[model samples]
Target: MHPQDSPSNRPTPVSADTREANRRQDHFGSREAIWLFGYGSLIWKADFAYRARRPALIEGYARRFWQGSHDHRGTPEAPGRVATLIHQPGSRCLGMAYLIGPEVLAPLDLREKNGYLRERVTLHFLDNDLADNDQPDVDDPLDDDGLTTARTAEGLVYIAGDANPAYLGDASDDSIAEQIAHAHGPSGPNSDYLLHLADALHAMGGEDDHVFGLATALRRRMRQAATHPATTD
Candidate 1:
């Protein structure tokens, strides 16, 4: 764990809008097409076009529901939590990487404009046999050492760091679940996002304790809410 990423080493909140700064980054070099990583809603909801996609992982990061969503998943008055990567040395985060043309960045930037800044990362592809295109079984045990990486590609990923204004920071699992269960925005109920990501991770043969924990807590809260509805005065 890097000292900068320590749970208590949170930075001061800055501007939430990061579209312009992301556009200024010139890490793509001369490549006509580049890879983009999607660890959250992008895993299940691929609204944009992509040439190809594969299960991939990045090092030194772990997914957590610390970022607050005011535009898509919740309102300004009561924001919903969203997933973001926090540096955890030796930890690997599994996600999907899409091969896309450079032109795709414009719309992607807009969609993830809420505190998400484009970060250059090295994507380690999981499947060695990309030519076959056979999906990996979700039930199989994840053998990181036994797995052969087809290749590694430089890619861009959206990360909402602590500097962002919408960052909600760390919270207890029960507290995070409470916010997600009752929050709603244009995309829909915040619980839907949590549940969908849980399901997506299962389908992708990825195990995230934080995500699964929140999903379990959210389900329990939902059940209680269903059984004991608040009556109007």
Candidate 2:
């Protein structure tokens, strides 16, 4: 659910309303179609139209739950953490990419307006071999003019960098998970967002220690909350 659809106790949003900024920056130029990468909710709940979808990965980045959500997953008083990409050499993050027409950017910009700015990146589409394997082969593909070249494409991704007001920065997994366990907002419980993303990655044969670790921690907190309802209250 979008923040517009519900009553909000949220303060004037802390993050910049990036819809206008994103609209002005024609990152795709005159291209009719462009690839868009989804490493978070867009991976499972694509509320937009797309022509094609593929399992894809980006190099030199690691997904971290450092972005804060004041409108969707939690309130302004107690924001929920969400995933954002951090530059990390030798690291790769698996996600889904969509080939979409330029018109689709309008709604997406609004949905991710909370400090998220559109950034361009190179996407590596997974082949059948990589998809079927128990562990994805994340080695940087050879740059030869063959399969790697054919499977790679330039795309846009929404990123909430530390410069943004809603960036919570780094924290312990348990601390992040604890906040997720208690926070709720227009979209629902924040833990649901964490679990849904984890499930989506597992289905795609993706392995992310960071994501899976938080999921594990969140579940443990949930179980404890269930077992000791009075203590939780």
Candidate 3:
């Protein structure tokens, strides 16, 4: 367990207004089910129960580790980095999508309370499989070329704004890896998050350059640490 895992290091409480804002902005009108796009920790540590899970792709965004984690992955003094989607034209992020019940809203909302805002996005499922029998069938939107587009569904994702206090903005891969390798919080070492995401992407026969590059640098740093243990006072 990491030092930040202590109860005292738990994340700050979510404001009532934030909760209400999420509820009000949710565009899942009268729908019995909701789709959620998971690009990072949700890939492996999705503690929340869900009905269906499938490979999905979202365009117009790139996964970046610019968000700072103060509770789950790090502390107030040295926050760990976490992945957040950044708007980038022509970029597509491959992730998983979950079909979940509405009751999950509150818990999900609180879990991502730190510097994250729930935003709606369109997900294109790679597989045609629909885990739920009652899920609605919607026509895929066509592009200008008149080609059949991937099956699409509207979903909510947690994204941190550049203006968020926890935002780290931009940094070199080595810099980010150094921070991740040394940071530990309630959840675990920050490097574990980066490596896990890279492994997940590899298993799916996909690649994310930014995540993989950081993971590579982090592994090298870990090797160095193992070879030269810190001296005791």
Candidate 4:
């Protein structure tokens, strides 16, 4: 179901006045803020032109590139694989923190529909003066508190899936690579997701070594395919 159709993500069925008030409150001002933690696609395709993307981390969630679903990502002919966050104890995953206007939530919610759910997480900007001072040049290391260590929010943010029976949390690198490469889009395969991510990370000059690690892995994988077409895909 679309995020708007999902009762959990929507405002309650209430009086018109109450609903209006709720909408007003949810409508964040230009400076009014919310933090979106991006680990996967959002890391690069954060369509929201954020006021500022601060380097911060939230604890408790470990990103596993395992989630598998035939409905949205895969097809009967060429099954695709994607990434989803998993609850892993005593562990941390690297990600980016986006402080954006509330207006962007609508599309973000919609993009993460069907199986995914949203849970709000409160992430601290490594620098309290978030926008002031020099923006960390791409790749500048900012400390992160994994899913367990960071503060959790009562409000909701979109999640990949919510207790989704179809959710599968583990997929092989080759599987993900093939899916990313083979993904059919009006313009191209979902491979652009990976390619853009590499480009974005490179553009941002991410100081985090982990992002570099994945970027390096993807580069090598793509190079391998280029060198030996028959072996790839």
TM-score of 1: 0.85
lDDT of 4: 0.49
| RMSD each, Å | 8.2, 7.5, 6.6, 10.8
Model 1, residue pairs in steric clash: none
- Tell me the tens digit of each residue's lDDT in model 1 across 20-110: 9888987657665677989999998889977567789999999999998877877776678889999999899999888777788989998
Candidate lDDT (C-alpha), each? 0.81, 0.81, 0.76, 0.49
Q: Per-residue error at 50 for model 1, in Å?
A: 0.5
lDDT of 4 at 101: 55
What range of 10 consecutive residues in model 4 has the weakest lDDT sum?
Answer: 12-21
CA deviation > 4 Å runs, candidate 4: 1-32, 68-79, 128-156, 186-188, 198-221, 231-233
Clashing pairs in 3: 4-186, 5-186
Predicted candidate 4 versus true structure: per-residue lDDT over 92-209, tens digit per residue: 5445677555677666654554345556565644444443343433442222312222344222344555345434444345545544455443334555555665566565454433
Which residue segments of model 1 deviate by more than 4 Å?
1-15, 131-150
Each model's TM-score?
0.85, 0.84, 0.82, 0.59
As for lDDT, the candidate ahead, 1 or 4, is 1
Please write out the lDDT profile of model 2 over residues 1-233, one tens digit for every residue: 43333222224356567888899988667665778999999999899987567789999999999888888898888777788999999999999887777889999998999989999999998865333232312462322313323488889999988888787777788878877776788989899999999999998889999999999999998898789885443
